[model samples]
Target: MHPIPRIGPTEAADRPRWSVIVPVHDCAPFLADALTGVLEQLAEDDCEVVVLDDDSTDDPARVVEQVGRDRVRFVVNPGRLGASATFNRGLELARGDLVHLLHGDDMVLPGFYSTMAAALDSTAALAAICRVEDVDIDSAPLYRTRSYRRGTGVWTDALDALAVSNRVRAPGIVVRRSGYELVGGFRTDLPHAADWDMWTRLAAHGRVAFVDEVLARYRRHPGSDTRARVLTGANVRERVAAIGVLAGYLEPRRRPWVTRRALVYATVFAARTSLSLARSGERRAAGVQLAEAARCLVQVPGGPPRISR
Candidate 1:
């Protein structure tokens, strides 16, 4: 392993470029490729890659060390600090003008940094986001791309769209350091939905630029965080919370549409949870989920009673 660069706070500020922060936890198998994707674009003088290993039980630290520490700064957490805490920590440690929160399982496509940096330079927005391609565990395409390009970049409508659906995947966003600090980074309370909450708050205060090209790859696996959120039904609660948050930002007429979508998503999530639990022979859990679904249905007047398959 090469010698790790002794990066001081001043040294990072002097670079005045992008800093890629990746929070790794039990993802040693994919960390190599993720780091490679980031380091390859750095141009030596432009950016630095920081990997915060949150007490990963896997051999991620060893691999990072073997890959050389000159371009990458590998920090090992004393204990497992969950994703939200890890991301916040990375933000605190980042020494760049801009921060890109790349997950350990995701990768940056070729020319990603240059393209986004140029976009940021041209615009006066606090952050810029690009379209993201969804890939399976084996890196195969998942048939649909996710993005946030509607509504002519209006903040209020963007907030509503985000509250209704998580079109802004975390990996696709590159936020300015000052803007990230202003929004207080990710919320530590909501472990599973902090990213959703953060983005909602981000759009409320500043302009967000959207690049239609797919510059990042978001990897989805059965054991991935997204999958866990879906299977455990945490996504429903997250979306509901997002709706409540957006109420403070959206117009009255738009509020109804946001509420309607929340209820619809909640109902569908409950049904999915019930069915999954039933298939696993957890009848009692399934019943509980069904009751929750019934409660959500009652909240919306004139709402459809049936949950779509």
Candidate 2:
């Protein structure tokens, strides 16, 4: 573990240790729960909440006002900005050492801030991530969890881990504000895979710490951008483009290996989308996804690996 740098008193007074920025758009139903969850964990004066309404049509301001604007600062965007831009706006407004961008529909579990903050403070890592529980619209558990590795510790093989898959879930991840600036914020272009691209870029800078516990809940509903894009088969191209960005950061010798892994990842992704569509009774969409998966397999250097149940 690397020693944490000591901060001067002047710096300490200017910035809070954690800035919880919730970006929302038409997520009124879940916004209250999200804010409540965050409010419960904020015990110290060194943390603050900033809710950015991304030109939401559904009165997100009412939700934040209900949560008490005195405790939570709220900002309504005059014009529409996408998720990445909205988050960037929040980042610009944040006055904290560690920046945490939580989706308005997602809720953080108890001890999320403390655990992640401690891990980050104890290590030289640029970011820290933990497991996330997948939940339904009503906050009911879906019995699924997302985590990058088994157990808890720092991840040294950041690039290879990302090459295998996006181990870091954005909602459960806490990043150093300086590190975010170093990476130049999230890419507005790679909308679907912007988080993946950001994670890879951060990993390139330093190690990423991991917490074993499920510190947050990611809502998995038809309304989410991810689910909607996946169902429509639009995320496939965005994902490939994201991998292209990842490839740019790699050494020439390692690019081929990573590219092969990326091809396999894309194939598996399409396969999953196809299976999901089949289960939803969308036969034509399922067939299209299958065809897309087959097309992606053609780019694999060693051909596609046989997938078994």
- Global lDDT scores for all candidate models: 0.74, 0.80
Worst 10 residues of 1 by lDDT: 1-10
Candidate number achieving the greatest lDDT relative to the actual structure: 2
Q: Which lDDT tens digits does candidate 1 get at residues 1-309?
A: 111122223354375587888898888888888888887778767787888989887887776887646778888887988887788889888888888999888888998888787777777677777888888878998855544555223233566666666667778888888777676767666667678777776777777777778888988778766656554556566666656665665677777777777787777778888899899898876876777777676666466655589
Give me the candidate number with maximum TM-score.
2
* Candidate 1 residue runs with Cα over 4 Å from true position: 1-13, 147-156, 225-232, 251-256, 268-293, 301-309
Summarize candidate 2's per-residue lDDT along 43-157 as a digit string, tens digits: 5588879999988889888888888547888898879988877877888878788889999999898899889988887787899988888888778888555555677778777
The TM-scores of all predictions, comma-separated, are 0.82, 0.90
Candidate 1: residue 4 Cα off by (Å): 33
CA displacement after TM-score superposition, residue 12 of candidate 2 (Å): 6.9
Task: List CA RMSD, all candidates.
Answer: 6.4, 5.1
